[model samples]
Target: MELSLDAKDTAFRDEVREFFSTGVPDSWRDRVRAGLRLSPDELTGYQQRLAARGWGAPTWPVEYGGTGWTPTQLCVFWSEAARADAPHQFHQGLELIGPIIFSYGSPEQKDYYLPRIIQAQDWWCQGYSEPGAGSDLASLRARADRDGDDYVLNGQKTWTSYAHVASQVFLLARTSHEARRQQGISLILAPMDTPGFRINPIATMDEKYHTNELFMDNARVPVANRVGDEGRGWEYGKVLLDRERMVAAANVIFLGQIVRGITDAARRRKIRGRALADDPGFAAKLAQFTVELTTLQAMVLRLLDDMTRGADSGPRGSMVKLRWSQLYQAGTALWVEALGPEAAQFAALDGATLPADMPAALQGALYARVTSIYGGSSEIQHNIIARRALGL
Candidate 1:
């Protein structure tokens, strides 16, 4: 499919580009470029700026503070943001839990959470994966027992991204064991400060505190905290998961990273007085990767077109996620190879001194290792394609 942006879409893209160039705080941009993590205040400030512009919640309905932009506009907005090195708007709140609350949450829940989320008053984290339940999410053992008006929750959540920085967590808890493994699950919203909640950081190869292990011991949350009916969380979770998968499939952000990787690799001298880009073998590989990247980007735009035209239940989302993850991993591998040993030895440098092109490309390659893992693993995406698209 040939991907072309209309005049209106191009205008919208320019608007978004201008906004990021001028609207996003310089400090945040510098931090992202330098490969340093944003402080909590800096992160919240950036999100609040988006929220102020009514660009905070991209995919939500307008009633819930969504920009109500067309899918193409959303695509452009994401591309511009990534290119400008803007702070990542954590999706756990806006992308994942906010939708769940708006869809299945009670009116009280909506009134209580949605506005704050849009205002950046609260940061949210996902409490889904547990120690043996990463991919087999239905096997999660986090339990919540109803008592009076409260549910006492007890269990652990591993790889909970940004939990330490969040004020609340949207969790999945097993309320019954008699029904199908997936059937008895319930979604709960618990304050991070609730008694018996502990967050321990998980160190990754990048030396960043991006993930955490959350332990909930007798955490008491009100029944009012329950989203949707009990034992139907599995169904609700599927809705949220579908949204997550669709967003993940949008390869715009990763595409920008790949572009940067190629540019950086080309500029740096490799061996024999030649840059990596001058090497025919490297050039061929870059050309091939770009072709695939372009194709995947087109697929992404097509998916957005379908969504803009009000098509739901499209399998292209899964296909995009699957292809993008594979292509990204491959592209990053090529990028690191081009960097030679420097890719491995580059310490996680502070954002201030980082060369513009190299840090993000290098760190992004490292972070892409989890792209296939989180938001549903590559294996799961394949299963979805086979079952939904291939009919195998």
Candidate 2:
């Protein structure tokens, strides 16, 4: 598919580019460029800055503080943000649960949560995954049994990113057991400080403190905290998952950034008095990666365009997720390779500033190893594409 931006779109892109260039603090962008994790306060502050400019929630309706930009404009914003190494807008609240609350939540829910989400007043994490149920999420066994005015939740959620830092969590609990799995699931909201909630940090190979194990035992959330009907949480989760799949576009943009960084580093390094970029072997690999990045980018733009035009676009999200995962791993691998053997050295795990691109590339590659696993595994995406996109 041919992708072209009209004049108006071009102007919007320029505006977005200019803002991201100057609006975000350079210190924050530097950390992001170096693949260093930003503190929770820094993240919230970045989103608040976006909020001041009315750009906090790009995909939400204008009524709910969204920019209401078209899909293309949203894509442009994301591209520019990645290029500038802008810290991402808080995704769990802004992208994942915010839209769901506005669309399916009660009026009180909207009043209480939507503004805080856009304002970044609260940190949020997802509570959908469990030790037993991950990609096959319907098998999740977390249960929330009803009491007089609240549901006593009992279960554990693993792989929950930012739970340790979050103030709130949107949880999926099996509210009914007699019905088929995936039919009786309910989406519930609970404060992290609620009774009987515990968080355990999981040390990842990437040396990041992002994921956590959450234990909830008799956690009392008001019945009113349930989003929408009791039995349709699975449907709401699917909506979030579709949006999550499309998020591969942003990762694709980051992969491009990694490749560019590697290319720049290669041009600066010399082998036998010749720049590494001058090596035909390395150049050939770079050329291949360029072609692959271009193909994947075009695929993402086409999917966004399809979505914009309100087309069915069956399984294209899965296709993008699958392709982007593979390409991300490959790109990060190239980054580490370009950086040489020293890139593998372990850096401090204290979220300290990575001094240079070498450590960044190494940590990124380590993290990239899980690109295919999270947000639905490549295996699952392949199955989805086979069944829905290819009619297998």
Candidate 3:
């Protein structure tokens, strides 16, 4: 069936697709389609191009360089962008911290940061998870002592995605000592150039430096760097999580795009002198996945519909995040399994080359392994679902 978008939405979608088809760099789209990581230059190039079009931060306040699109429109933009292999703007800057800054930051912070974020001038990484306190974020021991016009921060944040490359890091630090652990926290934006700030790179199984261990040894942060009121970061951080969950929820559609590539591979690969697509078992598996993908798409659209009507997303973002990660991981497993030995070979496609030892299908499978870990572990999300949604 055609997209469930109405005539107006369909028209808008066509416009976006056309824009992505022609406006986005052909070489960059080639890299995204082949699962090749874009170089830093290419990534920022795409981000700036999107910003120049006013599509860089679609969900932000229009006054802050956002599109002011409805949730459905936002959903359409993402789905179409992914299908067209458009490089997404950096999430730390575009999705996570931008909203936090807008909602809880000072007007001066907004004026300084929002345009830079949209224009891809500043790269951001999250500093929420600490060495000893990740899932139990409120119990974090990373303390920042107030010192006149500045706060002296001393702590280590682990699994800080892209911290090594980021120009800034948004930190959740304990600024107060109180009986209520949650009430002692505050959000601080630290420039990467701060004295005593460092990042130790950590490579994933995919052999990508997507994460790092962040060390802040008596880093000097100006009071002006603090967002919102002191001792309220736990609350603001939750807002960021809610937004993150919305992103993880949308992963269902992006992951679904892999199915199309898999099918094309199956068509070209022969099994016993016939196409793998002709195999009954493979066909059945494909059919099952189609059903699952359909359900996921429908569920996500419903969530977006609610947001379009101005209903709060709330814990439902967690629900979708949990389900999307699980489903996408499972689907990736099938992709690798179906490809078997053929996926073992690496060949350049769409002007992008795969890592010599890593085939496209296996690369995807390996990457999917971390879906349940980031954006809060499945266990953490389960607890959130139980406590907030189920009233446990």
Candidate 4:
């Protein structure tokens, strides 16, 4: 089918394309396309540039430093950004907590946090998952006891991404022991430098410090830092989770970029004096991925359209997350395999410069194993679709 945009969205797409071409630096794009990690300074600096242009938080309300674009425009922005290899803005702050603070926070809380988040001034991390609670987040055991104007927090949070670099954390702590596991949970904001807070990096097979374990030993936060009412954090967390899934729908565009890179590599590499791209077997696999990616893109558009019209696309985000994760893993595997044994030259976290394409592709495939595991896991998404969408 010919998937076409309306005149307005088409113009917006061209505008976004122009900005990415001119506004973003070529070095950043090259590094991102190679799957090399950008430093914190590089990330924040780029975000600041986007903020100055009033496009820092694309999906946010206009009153809150967003572009006020339609869902279609927002989709276009993310798609182009991915294709251009722009550094993704820190979503823990912009996509997750910024909305929560604005929608459920006190006036003082909004004034303090919103601008900082938009400008990338204060990096934030989520403190939701614990040793025993991840997919079933309501089972988190972090405790927060009221002590006058302060709440003393004590718990351990595992799989906390970017805690080592974050200046703040939004924690979900149990304030009371209610009969229902989901009840009595409260969202609390605390500075990472709090006297009793500690962060230790967890080593991964990729040789990267991408996640951490957090220890909160009597980390005292002002009661004013509480988001919404005490015991209503479960409700706020649900909102953030929903937004996270929906906002990530455009990630299929990145997969498209990966596939394009694979095709380019296939054309360049030769096997027995013939280009790998000419091999029927390899070409067929690439063609299948292209078709699957096109279908996923259509699903994303339909989800955006339904959201714009206030229609409930039940478990649609789950479906996208599930399919996208599977495709990402498969695409990365294909990319590395197509590169031959040269793909085994992997880059570590200590590398100062971007690795060669083959090495970077390998590193990316190693990391791709986590795609299906995080963001509520493939199993959870299947269960969601089975019960909600399929009525099975």
Ordered by TM-score, highest first, the candidates read 4, 2, 3, 1
C-alpha lDDT score of every prediction, in listed order: 0.77, 0.81, 0.78, 0.81
Clashes of each: 1, 0, 0, 0
Q: What is the TM-score of each candidate against the true structure?
A: 0.90, 0.93, 0.92, 0.94
Which portions of model 2 show Cα errors greater than 4 Å?
A: 1-3, 25-37, 348-355
Worst 10 residues of 2 by lDDT: 27-36
lDDT of 1 by residue, 29-122 (tens): 4335333357677778878888888887887889877888777677777777778767557667888889889998998899899989988899
Cα shift from native, residue 282, model 4 (Å): 0.7
What lDDT is obtained when candidate 2 is compared to the true structure? 0.81
Residue 298's lDDT within candidate 2 is: 86
Model 3 weakest lDDT span, ten residues long: 27-36
lDDT of 4 by residue, 1-392 (tens): 12368998888888888888866665564346544466778888888989888888887888777777777787778788787777566678988898899789998988889999988899999999999998998899999999999999999999999999999999999999999998999999999999999999999876667899999999999999999999989998767655755655656655666866687778878999999999999999999988888898888888888878978777888888888888877887788778877665555356544334645577667777888888789998888789987899
Please give the lDDT score for candidate 4: 0.81
Q: Positional deviation of 73 in candidate 3, in angstroms?
A: 1.4
